[model samples]
Target: MPTLTKPKEHNRERPVVFMENVSKIYPNGKTAVQNVSLEIEEGEFISFVGPSGCGKSTIFNMISGIIEHSVGKLEILGTTPTLARQQSTDVSFVFQEPTLLPWRSVLDNVMLPLEFRNVTKQEKLEKAHHVLKMVGLSEYTKALPRELSGGMKMRVSIARALVSKPKLLLMDEPFGALDEITRQNLQSELLRIWETEKMTVLFITHNVFEAVYLSTKIAVMTPSPGKVESVVEVPLPFPRNEDFRTSHQFSDIAAKVSQDLKF
Candidate 1:
């Protein structure tokens, strides 16, 4: 493991992810993101929330190196996302939909990441099985996507993201399509995984309660030419269970984030 370097006294903990005055503009002169800057502490689960066409997805794409920012710096684990990609740095992404292949079994879908960097078939299967166990889906390894329920399929997606043992996981509304009960269940599952694995997360969501319930801090983004309006820290203790949802502290933080979103 590489020796971790601390930042300054006030910002001493080196950020796992950093965005410095980043901006994105399309050829048609539409500015998607505007001068956004934020630092995400290592192992922190930070969420981005905003309305549609507010550049939330664009910001995610920039962080994932799916597209380059028009200006400023963006870093993941001290390296640009593009550089990290080149080095095969540990980072995984889960999209809104499960997006699993219908023909492939759950184990095969989870093992797909290994195929990208030349991992052997045997090694891929072993790693896939390990992560499947982590997500409580070991029993369904041979099941196809069509065979799983919505929540179960999302669990498979989560397992797939973990198969690579990434240090950072980027999720763009991974549970948006699920029913409320399932979304809440997956939210708790995600927190449990993060607590155990200590992976840094940059999640994008429209749901305020989900943002507060799952994040260490919520980054509120404004609509159009989207930029972070506030970073509200959720002081609630970790290993948070369903009981935390009914707590005053969680409600207060969630309310604050909700207000910020409407601004």
Candidate 2:
């Protein structure tokens, strides 16, 4: 069994995530990813973009330890991917939809992670309420999933992921299903969360605008044995707001990423 090996003291030299020439191939020899390498610094927000079937999600699965790589090495928080994932040491995944339990109340749902790890009831309630407040859902603690809007449910999912205090967050198109207005709102919320929590985020999105709006770095990929084609750094300053969206720099970077994705 794989065991977690977090450093006794936090090391400034260690990256939050590192994929060194990683690749994944299926049993039938279908190459899902090839020679992909990435290094994510602590507290950085990154977006991975490509057309459908570009192996974007496959990379995320490997980082999350849901799938093992066929070649090369990968590490999350200096611990092996399998150990990091098995222990839930420093990573969380937010899937496309808000997969909240329909039967559970909002507070209970947020506390589910604690339950999974055998946390005390008092600590679970406290942690759940704190994160719900951070996500602006404190008052709805007792409300059932059916009572919340789509956006609110997604917030619940986010709160659940955050309650674990993960250092690395792997998001697979968490906002793909929302309407334009809600999507933008959640995007802003995501940024706010990142700023306050200082977590390293690896987000996967097909929307070029959304990718540019949220990322500190954009990793572009190609399909059919997916490989990273380019990695562009966002030149904009931190604490970016609505005005930055209208700036020329944002447009230029977004355009460049768009042009790269076409291949």
Candidate 3:
């Protein structure tokens, strides 16, 4: 059996996200989450792993300011979630689906966020081109959504998310629909991008191996009325590659995360 490792300590001078006794209850009296508190430091890559309907996405929604928490305090970058979203380019979200406009070209889709900002057309194009290149999609700038593979479309979605230069990136199972190989490839690519961009990431996924492979820390939540059951640390160093995936440390960490999810 592999030994379980505790999450590493951080400086904790200031957290990018802070949630204290947070809960989300629907009007119908369904409580999706209860008494959940978590702190994420800047530039950390954190993954949330749990079974379906465990309120993982609910947490994401709360952080993104799409839905307010019913009780307790939630802060993003030291401000209210709503205020953080409206006042700063601090948060971005990538959903399960790419959700790209089929008629729009790759560059256009990536440029969509900048359209709402004060940037000029030339600036938007320049930023879009830069981000697309970062995601290895510069050659597909003119292709429409229909012309690209599922993985390519997701790359475009990620580019769009990065175009705004967010301090926090939230991804909710963005690669859930892709094939295993493609998903693994994107996982590696995302790690590279995360390192290069130096942005904080909160990723949600059902795949235990994926959560273990990509995150510095894994937040394991119990089923419904979800609370964080445990936070597991992956002690493996960064710049992980294919060999890392097959190593004993990787399997051990993945097994520990999987064991935690069983509760």
Alpha-carbon lDDT, every model: 0.86, 0.88, 0.92
Assess the local accuracy of residue 36 in candidate 2 as a C-alpha lDDT between 0 and 100. Answer: 86
Candidate 3 lDDT over 37-135, as tens digits, reads 888888889999998999999999999999999999898999999998898778999999999999999999999998888999999999999999999
What's the lDDT for candidate 3? 0.92
Model 1's number of clashes is 1
* Model 2 Cα lDDT, one tens digit per residue, 62-148: 989899999988988998888998877479999998899999999989988888787888888889998999999999999999999
lDDT of 1 by residue, 1-263 (tens): 11122356674655777888899999999999999888777788888889998999998888888899999988888888898766874888899898999999999898888887778888988898988988889899999999899999999999999988888899999999899998898888888889989899989998898988898888888889998887888777788888898988888998888888777
Model 3 misplaced stretches (Cα beyond 4 Å): 1-12
Worst 10 residues of 2 by lDDT: 1-10
lDDT of model 1 at residue 23? 94
In model 2, residue pairs whose N, Cα or C atoms come closer than 3 Å (at least 3 residues apart or on different chains), thus clashing, are: none
Q: Model 1 off-target regions past 4 Å?
A: 1-7, 10-13
Count the clashes in each prediction.
1, 0, 0
Worst 10 residues of 1 by lDDT: 1-10
